[model samples]
Target chain A: MSIPNDRKYLSTHEWHKAEGNVVTIGITQFAADELTDVTYVQLPRVGATLQAGGSFGEIESVKTASDLNCGVSGTVVAVNEALTNDPGLVNRDPFGQGWMIKVQVSDLNELNALLAPADYLKNAGH
Target chain B: MLKHTPFYDFHVSADARMVDYSGWEMPLMYRSVVDEHQQTRNSGSIFDVSHMGRLHFSGSDTRRFLNLVLTRPVDDMVVGQSRYALVCNESGGVLDDIIVSRDNKHYLMVCNAGNREKLIQYFTAFRREHDLDFDLADQTESTGMVALQGPKVIERLASVLPVDVKSIKRYHFETAKIMLIKLSVFRSGYTGEDGIEIILPAMMAGMAMKMLAGKMDKENATLKPAGLAARDTLRLEAGMPLYGHELDENIDPISAGLKWAVNLDSNFVGVQKLREIAAQGPKRVLVGLELEDRRIARQGTTLATSDGAPVGQVTSGTFSPTLQKSIAMAFVDADHSAIGTQLSADLKGSPSQARIVKLPFYKRSNP
Candidate 1:
């Protein structure tokens, strides 16, 4: 699967898609494939403050658990409610329906530190 | 360096996500752990278990040596019968749990992969100390093993296998020749399902797998290749004890809820210590825990009372695919092991409500 060229990513595998002042956050396809069957996803609550490079929540697959990190400092405007019932979406369609959070960016410049799609795919050794 | 099983090439060809497990490069999952887990429960799945150690023993003193070392009495076992037994240290702490099968001229012992080398050393030392006359052969690398498990396993195997698998009573094994290769098929498995585990020559594993698992890659195939990840979940849900998690040098079979497998009447290496433990009762007992929420209580998580008093620690945990709930196995203070006892699992810093429940969280309706 080709990396979506529109989004920026953290080296840890979280992706950031900025639309105006809001940025949609989710794990990359590579991370999802690595995680296998995602059983549960604990996302930061709406209105919670997130710090760039800080852990916001956790994602659990059958084998193990890993922390989910944020790419930009912002207030969480929304969380994916669908994940509460079906966490496997992250394994099936990680970029689209599996989006975890929508953050209203406090500083748009933080996105510059994130990796571009090509860089992420290269660094992740995809 | 990690070791590879005979099925390593098959796993790679099937696109398995391989991982290092106990110094062995084994497939952790083929596609999805949950899907593989469900396949075992509902239909059937094949597991490459060649990484486990297989030891063969033969001699006039084979049974006597085994009786001296194993917790279970081996004198009365008929040929082709298997018994689950545990090896314990002098203080009754578990060394490893094994399945000892009595064959016509030898005994077969299947043990955990990680404990293979340790057990070999232990057995050799014990044999010399006791001046026992028996032959112990390490056949782990020279032989291959696989478990075909699920509700539909017996029916499916009935068609391909030459022996009458359905007639082979549970816990019994039969020797058969398939395509000129000799093999032993035991009606046994760790997945808490109706299944059989086959042991054959390592060189013939690929051909045997193809013969047994016909067109497994097909979309509607009943027996697909599963991995270590799904096997862990299935065994956990079945309330079986794992070596590193539930059984270790510090944990005894009495405390791990395997008292039935222990024979105090017969004098074994740890019989005296085990007798004391059985009479006085174990200080800690294994129990099943059902968490109120989806958050998993991982191994080493502290267990406490509602008012915040530490009770025990989790040994293994997972979000059970069959039950759709967070379940864990924990060793709690014997006083707090009763069913319906309320407890809390300290998942890192967060507290999750937990309750003691009956073991074997899931049992097949037909079983």
Candidate 2:
């Protein structure tokens, strides 16, 4: 229900926590809340290359399925493997244990175009 | 005009995601569709089944009348008991699939909401043809139906709801009062869980929904309020046939893999044609198909052979929450309906490999 302000947010509802070149990415709390109960998460695989704004994964609810867009371009270094067994973790704690993948940012400058917590919250429709 | 259920405003107040379903403005989900689906599998979920119509048949010749009309024997179905039955035309085509429950001197039939009018006229015409003394009434407008499903529903409902559901057998019902509101509770649901479908009057509909909420809070229980979205996916994964997709004027119950429902020894209206069809199998058959890829094959998509020859078409398709795979039901050539029969589904001109599986794509622990 609460969005953490320390991470970088994307217009596509993904959040990033950058540490040096490696950055952790996950869907925002707002996104998970909007989607309600997540049934399946097709997370990006380790060592997969991704382009910014390109779809890297998918998530399916009961009636519909949606693509998970890549907010930051880079090789997927690490992925949260826990999601396959317990996708509900993403809904329970999107920012904490629900982080999808870790990617080495192709360009750190892309974060500059992303939104701040206040601005992201505004765009998320509260 | 599409009629709104009594709980229509309550759905809006709860912030249910709304969509137009068969011309009626109904909630697709309260929070999330998959979440609600899991709640029914793991815990409990409530549903607004008001859109399903209920028709009452009563009179002295209701027995003789039903025998001449429906494919099932109502005279054999004892009072306070329910039987899944089907009504077919004289030509052996399925008119609709319904549940006929014997209620006192009258017979209560619950049918698809979309075909209520047509079914009524068909039944009425049969009554006139047979010169039977029975009355048919549409109780759907005055009745409200809610499905409380899952393993935990019994524990949660026992606390606040004023009903002794312990005696209500599966597919059977009994009348009880809840918070001074009368209710006809049935121990049957589509979710394949141990639950009850409470039939309350329109004025008391909100009371039932509130009663479930009241019990959830009082017992510190968790129950999801599911909408039609989860209902569709859950039923599809359970391999249950929807009327329009699996049963229609073009299809018969025997071909749709529903032979137990059609009683041949009893001699119904469609008996002559059905007897012939039973001896010789129908043209097409319903089969389950599992796709390996995440790309789903939706309804009406053309089915094809491994070599890309058009064979049949998918009736319903969705991503299964339990199996973590895309599954669908399709009517195909009877010869190709066997298990592991490799085929391809033409998804918008692109073919996707699919394997034929058993009827139900997902089966729960219980039988």
Best by DockQ: 1
- Cα deviation at B330, candidate 1, in Å, is 0.5
Q: Quality of candidate 2's docking, in CAPRI categories?
A: acceptable
Across residues A1-126, which tens digit of lDDT does each residue of candidate 2 receive? 468878888877888888898878889877887776676788766889998878878875544567787667899999889988777788988999988889988798877777888888788777
Q: Estimate, for each residue in B1-367, the C-alpha lDDT of model 2 and write its tens digit.
A: 7678877987888788887766667888876667677888888888888888899988899888877778888776767898898888878888888888898878888898888889888878777877789889999879888889888887777776676776667888887786678888788888767888878889887766876655443233577678887888889988888988878887888888888888899888778888888888867788999986655778788888877777788988887877878788999988778899988887556577889999787677863
After aligning candidate 2 to the native by TM-score, how far in Å is the CA of A89 from where it should be?
A: 4.1
**Candidate 1 lDDT score at position B320:** 95
Give the 10-residue window scoring lowest on summed lDDT in candidate 1 chain A.
Answer: A56-65
Superposing all C-alpha atoms, what RMSD in Å does each candidate have to the true structure? 1.2, 4.1
Q: Give residue A105's error in model 2 in angstroms.
A: 4.6
Q: TM-scores for chain A, candidates in order?
A: 0.98, 0.92
Residue pairs in collision within model 1: none
- C-alpha lDDT values of all predictions: 0.93, 0.81
